[model samples]
Target chain A: MTEEIIIAGFGGQGVLSMGKILAYSGIMQDQEVSWMPSYGPEMRGGTANVTVILSDERISSPYLKIVDTAIILNQQSMDKFEESVKPGGVLIYDPNGITAHPTRTDIKIYQIEGTKLASEMGNKKIFNMIILGGYLKVKPVVKLENVIEGLKKSISERYHNLIPLNVEAITMGMNNIVPYKIEKHVFQN
Target chain B: MSELKLMKGNEALAEAAIRAGVDGYFGYPITPQTEIIEYLMTERPELRTGMVVLQAESEIAAINMVYGAASTGKKAMTSSSSPGISLKLEGISYLAGAELPAVIVNVVRGGPGLGTIQPSQADYFQSVKGGGHGDYKLYVLAPASVQEMADFVEDAFDIAFKYLAPVLILSDGLIGQMMEKVILKPQKPRMTNEELIEKNGSWATTGKKGRERNIITSLDLQSEKMEARVHRLMKKYEQMEKEDLRFEKINCDDAEYLIVAYGSSARISQKAVELARAKGIKLGLLRPITLFPFPKQALFELADQVKGILSVELNAGQMVEDVRLSVEFKVPVEHFGRTGGIIHTPEEILEALEQKIIKNGSIRHHKTRKSSIL
Candidate 1:
């Protein structure tokens, strides 16, 4: 199976690192993966995004016009990437700063209050991990063990003590995701 | 041997150079390629392997430093993006004229000037056709993957030392910035000064001990002497073209149309080839690994079998001229490209192939076969 995922958020939201962790997890599973970030001066305090592709076979073209999944964290990203998700695909968003909700009915939508939960947990840095956990809850593309191993590889040795907290945050996110169902009557008329 | 690790192309290149026993690295920071020097500095190769890494004040100074190190019979390298590479042309020409063995990497960005930091192959003509003055050719290797970005460092150094000429690793920001898994080679120690003196003593200046004073200069005032030197250089280039031509052919056995590209463009066109083939159109890809000693002879032979050829690139149109020259006008050769760091999608490339090359009906049998496939 192949999953083309786009993760977009503000610069300080760890969007690029989240995609990198997922790519490392794919490697742990002996799968081919590529991580390409939108790099430049604009990445500082601006909208940062990354495209990560995990496939059983060799991946071609790291850049894609359409993605199977979009992990959006901000309203700008929600508005920009809503139409780019493939039909019948999945879209996960954190209802933290998103003012405009996704309106696409053909795709599946889920919301996790990752920022609020992370604030409640007393550590705001684990926000991306929570969002990632929400994604894996709906579609378990990779095992939790591999993600833990991925965190070990991606994070530095000095930060090893924080893994348990990050793991707890991930579990909380997985348990708290709310499926956003669209009413049929809205489009029926 | 080291275990596989996920790394960016720039980082892998720096690590491979250190592992390949390079004596020194001198470079100035440039966009999309600054990671190479950053990795080197962070690793502190000087402490581990006695390898010297220096950040020069400018690209010109960096290349001159490479020239000085290479003159001492040491393996040295430098890397830069397009605008910085332009500043290095004069030193590069001097290196070629002096027949120095060194490696240079161009992580190409969009430019005729300081255009953009995005990836581009617009330097194809400038790189392969001799960017500097005079008639000299650099052994140009184009890497499409991060694995090759790591592996080609050793290969480029080997070829540079074997031929005693400068070699270039031609890549773009796409390959420079993207991350992938790479299996790194085992560490090798740098050569000692005595080894350099013994191996390259015939031409190298190693204190002129126990021999006539050896001189290294590209200047020859006599007309006939310069003419003979040019002829010798031409002969070496001819030999390299014959023995060092490298390319890859995919699904070409039964292909009716061929796509020619290199580096990142090759990776994109590979997807387009797969898409076209899935729709029952017989399309194939020809990727040239060495852009200088280009796979011209192979393209000439393949031109006889394919009905048409389309050249795709990130530049406006540079390598297409080489492709057309290779085919010698026997087949319908067309060009499609995007410039100024804009990359073309696979669907757009497929559409271009269908509209410009396939639907032109220049090949009599292809029109009927196309109808059956569609």
Candidate 2:
């Protein structure tokens, strides 16, 4: 099976690292993977996005125009990628700071209050892991164990002690994601 | 032993250089290729393999440093984007003239000058057609994946040393910046001074202890001697065409149309091939691994089999000229691409193939295809 995923958010939101973790998790599972980032000066506090493709066969293109899933975390990304998600695909987003929520009925939508959830968890840095967790809950594309292993590879040795906390955050993400019948567009923030 | 690792193309190239036993790496930072030097510095190959990694004052300084290291029969390399590469071209010409062995990587960005930091293949002409002003050709390799980005370091160094000439890894920022799972080889030991003597004693400045001092220079004032040198360079290029030329053919056996691209464009066209085939169109891809010793002969051979050829690049239309020349204009070879770092999508490629190759191949074919589409 092939899963072409696009992760987009603000630069500080760990969008790239989230894609990296997902890609590494794919590798851990013996899947072929590629990660291509939309990079530039725009990566500095501006909107950033990365396309991560995981496939059983050789992946042809790293960056894709259409994708199976779009994990959007901001309004700019929602505006850009909501239409690009393949019909009957999945879109997961953090409801925080998003003024315009996804409106694509053809694709499934899920929401997680990643920023508020991470704040509740007492670590805002794990916001991306929360989004990732929410995504995994919806699709189960990769396993929790592999994502933990993938995290070990992406984060430095000094952060090894933080894995349990990150894992907790991920579990929180997975547990809290709700399917989008919540016409409640913005976050409860 | 080899191990699988997720790595960006630039970082993989750096790690591969260390694993390849590259003696020294001199470079100036530039996007999106700064990761090469960043990885080198952070990984500290100097501590790991006794390799020297230095950030020179400028691109020119870095290339000249590579020149110095290479002239002494050391495996040396430098990497930069388009503008920085242009800065190094004069030194590159000098390296070619001096017949030094070194690996230069151009992680090209969009440019006629100071262009965008986004990826581009616009440097195709600058690379394969000899960017440096001289009667010389760099042994050029284009890598479509991170694996090849890592593997070609050793291969480029080998070719450079084998021919006592500069070799270039012509990568764009797309391949340089993208990450993929790559199987990395273990570190090999560096060539000992004795081995260097054995391999390059004829000309390398390896301290003339047992033999006469060898002088390395690209300048010989006599016109006939310079002519002979040019002829010798030509012979090396011809030899490269015959021996070192490399390419990959995907689904070409029964293909009615061909997409000829290299590096990232080839990777994109591979998907285009799949898209076209699913739609009942017979399309294939021809990926040139070596841009200088291009897949000219292969394209010429495919010309007889395919109805038309689409030369897809990330530039305006540089390599299409080479493609046309390769097929000798016998087939309708058209160019399709985007410039200023906008990567063409696979669907765009399929559309271009239908509109430019299948439809434009002939008026009758165009009408038939148009009716089918409608």
Candidate 3:
């Protein structure tokens, strides 16, 4: 199955990094993945967003207007991406940041207080990790252990000690999910 | 020995140049191509092989420096993107006219003017069909990945020295910016001064001792002499066509449809081939490793077998003309192109193949058809 995702927020909210983590995780799993960032002036302290495609098959283009999943961490991101989610898609939203509601009725929206969870975890910067945790709970495209290992590998040596804290956040987030198996549709002839 | 390392295309090009025994590297800093010069600077100090790496003040100075270094019978190279490459055309034309051996790289970006710093294959016509004035040709190699980036540099230099002509490595920003695993083979050392003076010292400005001082000039005062020079260069190109043609054929034997592409477009076309194969369509790709040689004979042989050919490119049908020239009227050749420095997707290429080559829809007929062949 093709997994297309968009992780968008204001600059410095770790949107691009989140997308990179997902892309790297996909690559580690031996799947074809491409991470493309928005070009033009949006790259300079502006609204930074990244589109990531992870597929079992070869990816044609690294672009998509209708994403299967969207993780919105900020109000601007929620406002921008609310309309782009495909029918029967999944959206992970930050209730503490986004005030607007999704327009589509076919999507399953999961609103979380990411800011509160980050504060409780003793670091506000780990909010993106929390989002990833929630995303993995629903979709579980990659193993949680692989995502944490990728996170540790991507960071500097000085931050290597923080792996346990990140794992704690992922474990806490996963514990909150009530496991449900959705029938995944495959486009096969 | 081959060593595999993670490198961007620009870095791989620089490392390849060093491994290919390039005597000198002259270039200016341009986005996407900056790493080439950076790689030279980082690697130049530790080099026991005695190579010269200089960052010129501007693109013009860089190309002219290449011209000077090449005139000295030393293997010299330069690199830039589209705009910077445009600035080097005057020097390129001079090098081609003088029949000098140099390796030039154009890490292509969006263009016409100061286009965005993104990947683009818009300079296909300017590169393959002689970017300079008069009649000349460059040995062009389009590389899709960082692996090809390192591999093509050696091939380009070999072709340049064999014919005493300029060779160009045509890559794009995507290849330049993206990182991939590269396996670089152990490089042979540079030629000795005595050996260079012996081989190319005939026309190269070495020294005027017992032998006459040969002036390295492209200017021929008499019209017949200049015309004769052009014909000689043409003959060298024809010889290259017969001897130095390089291409990669993928499952083309008895295929119903064929896809013709190069560089990054060729990589995407490979994915299209896999996708089409899964759908039970017999598809193949002809990736031209040497753009100047065009692989005309191979394409002609395939034309008799396949029903049609789809020319896929990142620009608006520049290489399509070359494919049409090769096949002539034997099979219908159509084009699937994208302009404005945008890359075409494999799905888009597959769709084009399904609609044009498979369904047999008549696209724009090229006027240059049969003008070169039949």
Best by TM-score: 2
- Comparing 1 with 3 on DockQ, the higher-scoring candidate is 1
How would you class the docking of model 1?
medium
Q: Report the Cα lDDT for candidate 3.
A: 0.81
Provide the overall lDDT of each model, using Cα atoms, as 2-decimal numbers. 0.91, 0.92, 0.81
Q: Write the per-residue lDDT of candidate 3 for residues A96-152, one digit (tens) a residue.
A: 755665555678877666678888878977877777788888899998777876676
* Candidate 3 segments whose C-alpha is farther than 4 A from its true place: A1-42, A47-189, B38-52, B187-203, B207-214, B360-374
Which of candidates 2 and 3 is the stronger one according to lDDT?
2
Tens-digit lDDT track of model 3 for B117-222: 7778889999988998989999888887777899988888888888889999999877776555567989878988889889888888877777999788789989
How accurate locally is residue A168 in candidate 1, as Cα lDDT from 0 to 100? 95
DockQ of 2: 0.78
Candidate 3, after superposition: displacement of residue B208 in Å?
4.8
TM-score of 1: 0.95
Candidate 2, residue A78: CA error in Å?
Answer: 0.9
Off by over 4 Å in 2: A182-189, B364-374
- Among the numbered candidates, top DockQ falls to 2
**DockQ per model, Cα:** 0.73, 0.78, 0.18
Candidate 2 CAPRI level = medium
Residue-pair clash count for candidate 3: 0
